[model samples]
Target: MRTWRLVRVVTLLLLAVSYCEFFHYYMVLLLCTWPSVSSVQGFQSHPLRAMFIGDTHILGSNAHWFDKLRREWMMTRSFQASMLIHSPDVVFVLGDLMDYGTESSSTEFEYHVQRFKRMFSTPFTTRTEIIVGNHDIGFHHMINDKRYERFKEAFSAPSVRLISVKDVIFVMVNSMALHGDGCSFCKEAEDALKNIKWQLKCSKGKLDQEKVAEICEKLDIMNYSRPILLQHFPLYRTSDSNCSTPDAAPLEEIDIPFRIKTDCLSKESTDLLFELLNPRLVVSAHTHHGCYRLHDNGIPEYTVASYNWRNKHNPTFFLAELTDQDFIINRCSLPDEHTVFTLYAIFAILLVIVIIIPPKKQKPNLGKSFTPSNKDH
Candidate 1:
């Protein structure tokens, strides 16, 4: 009888253990999976407003804190929805949509896609454009692989496309080649640019002295106003190697891979490219640090902070409100501890189920024996 009681206890304990495991697994999956919605509202009018968000690095397999950060992001759906409610004509995501290229999968990537879809949905169907970032290109390892192919396949279409919006001719440049493992695409890009330049001239467009000038000339001929260049890397001095500022310490600056480099259009090749492009406003994000500056030539370049674990302190986004005459730039900081606490509370509940519930279930079956004592009396 005692043996049977022991077996019963063991069975209950096993069931409790199984239940805990299943619950934890399901919660984790829920945390990682893409969110779904019934419907997306459309914008009511045309020529609406627009905003720019950059570097949302939403991938990691590390500590619970990472999941907490992700949950915080998940909660921002309402915040983003409010922006759409204000009727932004378009939304520009600068770069670094995902943290690791190697970690890209159908399921994982879909999670990111769904997140963006939820945040950027509109009533009148606002357009959302995404530019390729360094992480999107696989950093240093194999360049232009399945992940890249998948990204292009997913976002290269007309819906989530690359095109000029209104007066701002947005050019989504793939800047990963500068730090990619090979030089194949780098050469190919250079060749493509040369061909594009020729095509512009053939179309009766005069070439400018600088690369920016040529690009602007071509865009101008196409009826595009001042071009706003969007790339993954900053065009200005991101490092203090050339200039000095009290706030410009090496540690204080964003430390990207050593393979990648940045300069303010004076590094010969890159300088020529920027000078020719002569973009009115250049927006980029890769260093995960945020900065906004105006060059001597009156061009403004802004770097957006990342929405990832690395940039927890400044987990914010840039909002560019464009009018007919000019645009206003605003930095909106994401929600901090309130959202984080909700996630922690969820994990804490799971921890209790996993560690406490099973042991309590196995505590001897004393109630069963006591019930039968009535017959003996």
Candidate 2:
């Protein structure tokens, strides 16, 4: 009986200790480390400047942590407040702002909407544009969620949106609906896809050729000599896939996984998208692993890392400074000091739990001489 009692006490104590440690880890992660503004060494002013961010994936249950991190990074203010402290002409979010679409409740959806409203609240000299990602569409395998519709309602539009800033045109397209079985053959969506497809395609495929022409025509209409393309998925090879160069190392060699389902866009669609847009530069993020490559075609595509729990060391953003001679792209990491401190704080909490939950004590047994039969005799 005594032994059983001791074991029960030990179990209860351990459970209590674990609970405390878990709560402490989350608290420190959300509130302890904050980011500060830092300057890029050789930033230059452009006729127009733009800042790009993607794959935020904020939710009410876990948004506080993101909010804390964003606040630290000085992202809650205008773009001009940070690296673009001079004030960028525009801000673009590539996609995946929320984790899941319509399945996300009103409260959860509103939480993400509010976070954006707060983060980019500063008056911008340029426009703010957003593209839809796979998560924003909800269940890309099927079109039943209608989450994209909700997102449109919250964000104010669907399909493609064009912004002309400082005589430069920025085209933001919804890539989620293109290849997903859920949206296959959606007439309106198909038409939009066809329009984008025609502008990008350059070869024998009618759809591809049409897309390329359309994009060129759009540039003509804008009369812009240089444009920038922004999308959630990259048109080039993904981090997990085989590289174009035989000498290149595989993704795993670089600490990236072979497949990240949420980040992948079909190779066929990406090739088509890249071929048509042919922008001066392309920026995207979904792979979580940051990648910078100048394709054989001379187009530069950059994938920004994420600011989530999974990507602890790679929370990052891009700074593009336009100069007369050339445009410079700088990939910057958020403060590492706070992240390191947070990690230590978590370790300390776990250690405390171990110390507080004492091991079970062995109970003393009654002697055989004290048996009931002997006592009776």
Candidate 3:
């Protein structure tokens, strides 16, 4: 009886420990709700539900096994939990998908990609799209053909891509290629941007029919929508010091200056992108913290926080409901690393206590034990 009681208690404790580490994400299934724009809430359109994840930064060979396992598990659980609840039509990974992608060999890079797929796997009905990040390839000045090609092959990511979902056009750009140096990659990116611009113009009925026939023969867009710019780097910004949004960089780091073209796109590149794309909304992920800012042109940009625990204590993602003329972005947070660790610590202490403290020894039933059965004598 004592053994069984002890076993039951231990099992319950183990279950609690599991919940602290893994099952915690399951709560978000109930907690997370699809936020709606009040004005458009009553609209009868089937809004395109899209989930955006920031830098996953799947660690490479150099990371410790425990760190890799912990971080990856957190990402997997959070993503899968939210996916189950939201059932988004499309998912966008806003770059920096790997930590050492630029440094890894072909085999190592492949492994990272495989691991990322496992971590962020989604249902077949939901489409996944990715954009290239500086880490996925390299900085413009240091990018090489081998690295760039391997990344593109791995993720099917291009320097610039246009995807239309539910009449909402998402312009995915490789921010790394926006160095404005007119290198071969830069030139290619610019050309793709021009093509995308023409497609948008055609959609808006702004281009002459002849112009559309000349350049937009392949674009089969049936409805018009402003482009939503998706990239790996944020637009030009000095720093997040003045950013008042929740989950902005920590107070101490907010004032640190961002390096032009490295931390953010160069001013020239930013101007060129805005002029060409004329995006109604922009979403980027390289900063690894949340920032909601409106450009001088009055377009809103949401910088998603990193989805990986290694980047921030409180990781988060963006849930966007997009329509042809409206977009609503909600910042959804994941389980905090510090909170999870604290729970683990607490559970470990309780588990130790359960093991160390002896189960009470039941007082022997003296009457029954000592009273001998009167056999027939």
* Candidate achieving the largest lDDT: 3
Worst 10 residues of 2 by lDDT: 29-38
lDDT of 1 by residue, 1-377 (tens): 45555665566566555543333323322222111122123232323255666667655444377574554354345235444334456777777676664566677677766655665455655677777766665653455456766777777721112245553455556665443233766555555545434433433445456854645545434433445667777764645343232222245444433232532222444454454455567777765656777766788777666654345543555556542234556565544335445555665565555554443445566564433455655
Across residues 43-77, which tens digit of lDDT does each residue of candidate 2 receive? 43434566667776654454477555644333332
lDDT of 1 at 131: 77
lDDT of each: 0.53, 0.56, 0.86
Over the stretch 118-235, how does candidate 3's per-residue lDDT look in tens digits? Answer: 8888999899999888888888877999999988888898899888887778889999888887899989999999987877887788777787788678876557777899999999
C-alpha TM-score for every candidate: 0.60, 0.61, 0.91
lDDT order, best first, reads 3, 2, 1
Off by over 4 Å in 1: 1-48, 60-75, 105-124, 157-162, 179-182, 192-221, 236-259, 262-269, 323-325, 338-377
Model 3: lowest-lDDT 10 consecutive positions:
36-45
Give the least accurate 10-residue stretch of model 1, judged by summed lDDT.
Answer: 31-40
